[model samples]
Target: MNTTTVITHQPVAPAPVVVKITERDWSTSLCGCFDDMASCMYGMACAPCFACKVSSKAGENCCAPCCVPGAMIAIRMKVRTRLHIRGSLCSDCIIDSCCGPCSACQLSREIDNSCNGHLM
Candidate 1:
């Protein structure tokens, strides 16, 4: 007597994983005050306003963007997580809270860089 065996394979393969990263490092550093004169001036003149504008340009609410407590930290975390930027929430909070103007300038630069330097 003889026996026959048959084998079958899946038609489609598994989907590929996609990862999105913002950039290797921040467009500007926390103390790089002269990196972006405009951004630095704006941040220094009005940190809240600058943060709000940055948030708006980055697809977030314009008003009260950084007015609320922990708002900057929250936004930073959100942006970092979405863009796959490596950082901790605690560090974000500390940085934003300690250096408001620097943080705002950095955030603005980051958003602009992420959006390819366009007014998105």
Candidate 2:
């Protein structure tokens, strides 16, 4: 006499999906501060206040920039990372160090545009 065995195959769970984020340029350029006169004036009139505002808008503590040294660069990095904007820490440093007010205004505009669905 001979005996035979049967085997059955079961389906396995599918692999996890990986989303590839395509880095893009900032919604507004660093020097595009003047494009939004309101923000530009606000930033120029009171840079610290503007920085704090942008910091808060970016989801960081409002006072972080005022209390922490080089916090703007960190804020820029955070915003850049959050928005998947293509930029480097060195460039952020240069922008913030050269014209802090302008950087703040740009960040503000970027945040505004992001919130307004202007960025894809």
TM-scores for the candidates: 0.72, 0.81
Candidate 1 C-alpha lDDT tens digits along 48-73:
78888777766677775645677777
Q: After superposition, how far is residue 43 of candidate 1 from its true place, in Å?
A: 0.6
Candidate 1, residue 77: lDDT: 75
lDDT by candidate, in order shown: 0.74, 0.87
Give the poorly placed runs of model 2, Cα more than 4 Å off. Answer: 1-16, 117-120
What's model 1's lDDT at 78?
A: 73
Instruction: Please give the lDDT score for candidate 1.
Output: 0.74
Q: Write the per-residue lDDT of candidate 2 for residues 1-120, one digit (tens) a residue.
A: 999977687779999999999999988888896679988988999999988888888888889999999999998888888899998999999999999999988888988888662222
